[model samples]
Target: MRWTALYARSRHLTVALAAVLLCAAVLPLLLGDSWSTVFATVTLGAAVAVAGVGLSGQDLDLDRTASFRWPPRRLTHLLVIGVVAGGVMLAAQGLADLPIDSSWILRDVAGLLGLTGLAATLFGGQFGWTLPMGWAMTAALVPKAVGQAYDVVAWPMATADSAQAWWVAGLLFVAGTAAYTMAGAHR
Candidate 1:
């Protein structure tokens, strides 16, 4: 079917499965108060980005030359996927014990979506998830890595000063939009 190709190439399901599996495996320990706030938001954000990486800059030259395309442009693709990932994650909160604040979910969606977009634009979609996810993991594992010199890094905001997470998320989105939209037309 015409739609099958569209759905097939996109990696939304991959991201979703990865997110569910991660939650399944880690949710137990993250339950109660600890899992309901910024901590949970940060973890889910990275997982969601892993799947979103596939949608970034896929077969660009081929798409330009093809009769059909996955997305009209990289920016549109990222925006749609980012919003979808955010909505999905927001819905997920309803079923589980996540933060009561919608801001947390919004923050996660923005950060992960932007990070993935930027990574895919810079590193290629196949391995785009590496930087964002890696940085998030590092921040969660080693808070000292990001440093206060760059609070916009975000993941550290999970435990550091969460008030700034919104700014961090916005920065990632803006930078990622620039990267993906203005990316070199090599591919």
Candidate 2:
């Protein structure tokens, strides 16, 4: 119990949770009865971006010095971030009576979380938010079209039924999870 609390504090989990909740709650209210795909994508991006800060601890050296194995912990942390962000968004959408599908939210959250993990592994935990936000921005700015290539590039904003988007998101989730689990975050 004590150890769990200490771990949460060290990783700033409370702050991340609060920020995720806030983003989730606010976005639905702001959109009101007009929910767009782009808005949903941006909302998920904001939630992941704020929560991703805890992907690494305060000191990489200190984390390395710890006695316990890290891979499992890292994997669990990433999964928890996905669940929290996705769950909050789903709940908010439900409250707003929006018609967003669960599969779409799940896909976006998975891919975004994967990007967060990949960023943490490549650029350190502090930078974990960059890849997701950057990708989301790109997805938002790109003109919508109908094509496999476009679906891959805009996977974050792709419709739930897009096969290309699902494949891309799945690949990203697997690769990012594996990399982050094995390498942890960069110093």
Question: Pick by TM-score: which candidate is best?
Answer: 2
Please report, as a residue range, the 10-residue window in candidate 1 with the lowest summed lDDT. Answer: 152-161
Q: Rate the local accuracy (lDDT) of all candidates.
A: 0.59, 0.88
Q: What is the C-alpha lDDT profile of model 1 across 83-147, one tens digit per residue? A: 66556555656666454556756666677777777777677777666766666665555444666
- After superposition, candidate 1 runs with Cα above 4 Å error: 1-4, 10-42, 56-60, 67-73, 144-151, 154-156, 159-163, 184-187
Summarize candidate 2's per-residue lDDT along 53-152 as a digit string, tens digits.
7899888898888888999999999999999999999998888988788999999998998899999999999999998888988998877765667799
Which numbered prediction scores highest in lDDT against the true structure?
2
TM-scores for all candidates: the values are 0.68, 0.96
Give the Å shift of residue 88 in candidate 2: 0.6
Q: What ranges in model 2 sit over 4 Å off?
A: none
Instruction: Flag clash pairs in model 1.
Output: 15-51, 61-187
What lDDT is reached at residue 186 by model 2? Answer: 93
